[model samples]
Target: MSFLFNSYPLARAALFSMDAEKAHDLTLSALQKAYDCSLTRGLLAAHPQLPCTLMGLSLRNPVGLAAGLDKNGAHIDALGNLGFGFVEVGTVTPKAQPGNPRPRMFRLPRAQCLINRMGFNNHGLDAFIANVRKSQWRSQGGILGLNIGKNAATPIDNAVDDYLLGLEGVYAHADYITVNISSPNTANLRNLQGRDALSALLSPLQEKRKMLEDQYGRRVPLAIKIAPDLTTEEIDVIANLLPQHGIDGVIATNTTLARDAVQGLPYANEAGGLSGPPVHALSLAVISRLREQLGAGYPIIGVGGIATGRQAQEKIAAGANAVQLYTGLIYQGPALVQQCVNALR
Candidate 1:
């Protein structure tokens, strides 16, 4: 069998022919069917194990699937079979939402880029936890990170409540929980990154985490996802505050609002977050700056525009403890996982 069950070039050609979001849904559905029929992990290429630890969590490899790929955790077993060391899912909100209008996701094959304004459209928390319960991925021992975000209708000031609710629901199930305050699709969501705002948010969250740790008997690490569009002073402020508030780690970036790298390209002017090759340098810049401020031993998961093993190595070279892929996987295929682990090891 080939690395990805079928040659990815063929699969990509087929998928790329359809509307971006529809193709996304079709792919996941087919994978779920493949998994249900017991094709399971064997249907996908097996990545070599490159053991490492991150924020006290042991991973078989450091290459992981970034969030927004499987928003509801419905395809965990199928995706987990593809050989990611960890699979992070969702940006799921408290209520089911339809997200932004049609054509929300766009591809820029020219630069291997994607622009999306997907506004956290996901099944509600209850349904999400149910999907988590149904997943067989955890039995295989790879780590799982559950990414959570606030609903669009929720007032900005009240966002902490939504995050708190997310923590309460996913805390017991997650190997680590990612607090998403960085997605540009949601209104004023990025405002949560401000000094006073971050302080306010983390204080309650860390306090709640302490309570949950005592209750669940496991202390799931908490990571805040930030945007690549931050200022130097803003980055420094967050770096200092993380340790102070007991935030365990930081996912160096979500996506970029700047289209500097994709100017004049179709969808380059789309009103959404830009991800892929264009965001690679921006993500690396944030990761490097974060490392300089956070110093060694602080966990950072570098992601954005990593389409090759060399770029994956570059993230580590820039001080990332591990790396993740979203747009890269869309364009480069599952083979990128093993390639990255092989390179990292």
Candidate 2:
């Protein structure tokens, strides 16, 4: 564990020197190899105080690795070993697609942020399910959140079909599933957050979920991941709809399209969602508003710009039942997971 903490600076330096997307690929490859060799097990010291429960799932800690980091479930065990209580993978679609073109991911080192328009480039549900089945963490009953989305080619009006397909495919394998309709990279995807669209999307999915529960003999929870760029009125509408739809939880924020916080920085004008410190305040604001509308019992998984222990604590204070990380891992290294867990304790 100490070795992991001590060695990351040099590792990060090498990664930071390369193209952001390439660096990400290399990191995933290395992590995969480490897991294959069983070298990642116990690589971090576990914090006992981090235990909690959300959406009926028993999390070993409140800190989790966010979706988009694993897009596929390929590295769940390896990531789980890094001290996150849970690991979410995928914004996986029903079919395999290449996603947006190259150089789609950027790093704004000055703001400790990243901008990406990767779309939902995943190896389709078949490959994703295979990876999920291969994961040792899943075998061990570690909480796994499978995030689902529509294919880029799927029209917005017919988007429900794609989501329904996603639901049917991953339902049995996931501990909970997240309907991701807020990524800015996907065209018109955020429109699903509107009142009519949101209701239309969730109502049928909720019906299917009940049928799935009867088939599987367990009621796997469903959470919706929303964007941070929403207006207060938009938040109010969503808050009202969630419980009405019988949704089990909400992940407050995907990434933001707004770049106000990173103005003047390189890649600040990139056409994608901006994450890291720039998103911290926006995410907290959304969570605070959602907390106010949803009352005390609804589960909210807050995620966005959580780069430090204090920020993680602040998210909880703002009413998140648990929190997740992605860009923070890029700048702060894996130790951030334990740092957050310790702070939450």
Candidate 3:
């Protein structure tokens, strides 16, 4: 692995220097091509006996690949082999979109961070489910979670309809569904975090979940993905409101807007959400606070700036049932996954 990455550092540098969104497209295409071959898949598979369970779904390990990396489920088979306990695909919308304009993603390698306002650009629900359906790789005992959201044009007042549209399409394929109400890119979308709005958003979704249970002959858990930029008051509100809506779990942190850690770097002031080392402290703080309010047994998926076994252990100690990595993978490569899993064990 060292030899492989070392030789390509210059190539990787050139890719990073290009347009961020376009580079992502090229990277995904390359991965898909590599994974289409049997040899690469075999190389990426995890060892046996690495299983962990959360929210009724058994995972191959506790470490997972967070959302935004595979926006449309196009590379599930390829990525599944990299040994993630779980892989979350999409922040899929009720309708397809082109997302925000060019240069919407930026890399802060010095800080091991990424800032993106890709605006949930993805193929619509049908295409998303179709891609997921085509993937041949399922975790040996691992789980798959689908993160759902509203279309960029969907009015905040009617966000429930958009979420319900996604739930209808993805419920059958996912081990669990995440309600993404925290992304800072959409106009006023975070307003759904308010009391009445959150209730309006979740109440109908829970009803749809019940219907899905009846149709599928089983229950599927539902979780909410939050931002790391909230205040103590906002966190308290979520802890109080979650149980009321039968929320199955919480994904504590998507990305952050703060620049404290990435200050003085190029692209540091980019208009998007940042995720990486800069976010480590804030994300951990949110997890700790949530644990304090929600108490024991509230399932939390800790994500943000986790790159080492010690970092993963810290999140677990802070009350995360499972942990996820995005930026860390960008900085450390696939081997980081196994390293952290081994360390946790």
Task: Provide backbone clash counts, one per model.
Answer: 0, 0, 0
Clashing pairs in 1: none
In candidate 2 the C-alpha lDDT for residue 2 amounts to 76
Error of 3 at 56 (Å): 1.3
For candidate 1, the TM-score is 0.98
Q: What is candidate 1's lDDT per residue for 1-345, written digit by digit as tens?
A: 355544778889999999999999998998777667755546664766989999999998999999999999999878888889999999889889989988899999998989899999999899999999888788779789999999999999999999999999999889999999999999999999999999999999999999999999989999999999999999999999999999999997898999888889987899999999878898899999999999999999999989999999999999999999999888878888888998898
**Worst 10 contiguous positions by lDDT, candidate 1:** 38-47
For candidate 2, the 10 contiguous residues with the lowest summed lDDT are 39-48
lDDT of 3 by residue, 1-345 (tens): 344434445657777788777877887787777677777646545552467778878877889889989989989877777778888999899889989987798888888788998898989899999998877655344478898999989888888999999998999888888999999898888888878888888899999999999999989899999989989999999988999889999998888888888789999999989988777788899999999999898889999999788898989888898899888877777777877898788
Best by lDDT: 2
For residues 1-345, what per-residue lDDT tens digits would candidate 2 score against the true structure?
778776888999999999999999999888767767744545643443566899988988889989999998888887887878888999899999999998899999999999999999999999999999888786775789999999999999999999999999999899999999999998999999999999999999999999999999999999999999999999999999999999999998889988888899999999999999879899999999999999999999999999999999999999999999999999999888888988998
TM-score of 3: 0.95
Which should have the higher lDDT, number 2 or number 3? 2
